[model samples]
Target: MGRKTEQTMRTYHRYLGFFLAGIMAMYAISGIVLIFRNTDYLKKDVQVEKKLEPQLTVANLGKAIHKKNLKVEKEEGGLIYFETGTYNTITGEAQYLEKRLPLILDKMTKIHKANSDHPLFFLNIFFGLSLLFFVVSAFWMFRPNTPIFKKGLYFTLGGVLLTLILLFV
Candidate 1:
């Protein structure tokens, strides 16, 4: 509650906010793009052909093609059929239609959705903790008894309420 402590908190908050601005913008843009991922918006379809080891089973074919939740609609003779394309068991050939975002956009989305396997997972943890620090540092910007801080508390509560509403709906 001392004057020097408040000043230090504000300084850290200000600089950290500036330092994270670029990454924050990237996440915002990536989030918006991901909302349209199910659709072909800003995406291009390409005919992809792959040649793997022959005689792969349906599960193995899915693994070879790097597809998840692959459904084998129908299998006839040597060909395995799926929603996007076909695989030949005897030939170890795969031909499929693949929808892809532009290279930079694709990288952005991948960074946004970093998993534990990715090197960026540690960066994600740091970024998440930094964001939490920003939230806590905001309270230190003003003393609790001030009118402005009281008003900020109301605004914060409103934001929390809105988030809860969005979560259920």
Candidate 2:
């Protein structure tokens, strides 16, 4: 590559690395948390109150509250009881006790799992592109003939091999 192109890559890579350091840390932490999501690690049960659409049926209550497999276990007077909490049919109020990670960790996990329906999806795309740029620009950081660059290639190959092994095993 041209000297100018290599210089540009190095400059942008350095600045982007500095800019994205915090977000990268967040992704790493959140990713680790998600691996143990099936367990109750770092979780506490808290009461949550939500105002949903009024006069919802038991079948639709789960969708409104964003829970799955939720059913009304019983009904007494104006309240519908479920495994986690109760909903007042007369009003649009739902009160549930749910186990969740702490607020900040929960928010981080939400960002980590953002979909197309969420605004954080754009951030996901940007972060993915930034990571791709980092991978490519790293090659420009050192000349291909250097010992450091040769050692880096060996490390990169090892990483790729490890990833493939984990994928199949």
Candidate 3:
């Protein structure tokens, strides 16, 4: 590309990189946190209580309480007991303990999960498009004839290859 195009691309790349630095760091941290989701790596249990529909059946009770397995340790005197807590079969008062990530990390991790209904959905779209722009603009950071540009191409190829291997293998 011409000098003007290269300079323009570099300007956009540099300024946009600076502007998105904080969000990028958050995305990175959230991604790392998600890797440990299968376990309670950074989570805590909190007591939860909810009043559900009364007189629910054994099956419906689990659905209402939003628990899997729904094992009834014992039911006595219109109450059902389970691993986490107990439930009132007559009045539908359920108490349980739920594990949750802390507030700040929870909110951070939610950014990637934002759907069309979320306000951050627009931010997701904008960040994604800006990332595409960054990829294209990176080529303009150095002239194609330069040694560093050639080395960058090699590194880019290695990165793409490593990603593909990790994705499919």
Candidate 4:
């Protein structure tokens, strides 16, 4: 590539690296948190004690948990639990583990999980393609014969090999 092209690639790589730094951090943290999904360590425990109205039906449990109108078909023991909503009844409290990501990170994560109905689906696709372009452009940022480029090539090969092994092995 010409000097100007190389410089332009380097400039793009540097700025994109900076723009993605915070997002990278969020993904790292959320990824780690997601790895321990089977545990409650990352979740905050909420305790609630309230006197439910007498003559309550098993069907009315969802309302007792502040999620009224929830379809609850049965009541077990002193508690009524909704099949798909919040639960708060009896001495035993319902555990709600929630994590609120920062606005930008949250939006990015939502875009990643976007469906066709999501308004930012097109933008998400564009950003993803731009990232792929950046990855391909990285090679031209350095001279083909440079040691760093050679080392990077070797590392890239090793990473691919490892991924393939993990996928099939």
Candidate 5:
């Protein structure tokens, strides 16, 4: 690469690293938290009360409250008892205990899981491109003939190999 290109890459890489440090940390922390999603790690149950449409059936109640596997255990005097809590058919009140992470952690996880349909998808794409830029810019940090550059290549190969092994084995 030309000296000018190398210099530009190095400058941009350093600045971008600084700019993206907070987001990168968020991704790292959220990724680690997501690995424990199946477990109840860092989750707390809190009682939640919501006002839904009145006189909803058991099937409609589940859809209204955004609970998928909601089963009505029993009914007594227009009130229905489910797994987490109870709902009154006569009134538009639904009381439930939901287990969730703290607000900030939950938001981080949501951002981590953002899909094409989500507003955060644009941020995800930008972050992905920034990471790709970092990977490419790294090559321009040092000349290919240098010992440090050669060692970096070896480390890169090791990372690729480790990723493949984890993926397939």
Candidate 6:
């Protein structure tokens, strides 16, 4: 390869790596957190209690649970739960705990969970392509005949084989 082309490839790989490092770290952390999604590790619990004076209609019961004013979407059981509502029913005192994620990371986490139509989805796809570039660029980082390059090739092949086996099996 010519000196200028090789140098340009190196610069492209280097700058892309630098640009993506922080976002990569964010993905790694959030991905780990998502793997344990059902757990309470990242959520803070807030206990809420409300008093009711009404004679406990299903709609009223649901409103109490939701702690907001909401239209009764559907009613099941003798109790009522609206999409969002606040109500007072004669059940001694109704209380529940609300789980809330931390503010800033929560926004990032939402973006991470976004679907294809979401604005962040394009950014996510770009990030994934950047990762693919990082992996491919790694090969050009070294000359083909170099020992390091050969070892890296073997490792990459092994990784691909392992993934294929896992997928098929």
Estimated TM-score per prediction? 0.87, 0.83, 0.89, 0.59, 0.87, 0.67
lDDT of 5: 0.94
* Candidate 2 TM-score versus the reference: 0.83
Give lDDT tens digits, candidate 3, residues 1-169. Answer: 7999999999999999999999999999999999998899999999999999888877898888777778889989998888899889788899999878999899999886788999769999999999999999999999999999999999999999999999999
- Please provide, for model 4 over 1-169, each residue's C-alpha lDDT reduced to its tens digit, 9 standing for 90 to 100: 8889998888888898788776566556666655665565445544444455555554564445554456654566755555543344555455332334455545545555677798767865766676787878889878988999999999889988999999999
Q: In model 3, which regions exceed 4 Å deviation?
A: 57-70
* Candidate 1 runs further than 4 Å off: 69-77
Q: Return the clash pairs for model 5, or none.
A: none
Q: How close is candidate 1 to the true structure, as a TM-score?
A: 0.87
Stretches of model 5 off by over 4 angstroms after superposition: 55-59
Ranking by lDDT: 5, 2, 1, 3, 6, 4
Residue 17's lDDT within candidate 3 is 99
Residue pairs with colliding backbones in model 1 are none
State the RMSD for candidate 4: 7.1
Query: Residues 92-160, candidate 1, lDDT per residue (tens digit)?
Result: 889999899999899999999999999869999999999999998999999989999999999999999
lDDT of 2 at 133: 99
Clashing pairs in 3: none
Worst 10 residues of 3 by lDDT: 61-70
TM-score top scorer: 3
Better of 5 and 6 by TM-score: 5
Between candidates 1 and 4, the one scoring higher on TM-score is 1
lDDT of 6 by residue, 19-96 (tens): 988998888877777777677788897767677655676545555465444455544443444443333343535455
In model 6, which regions exceed 4 Å deviation?
A: 1-3, 46-96
Deviation (Å) of 3 in candidate 4:
2.2
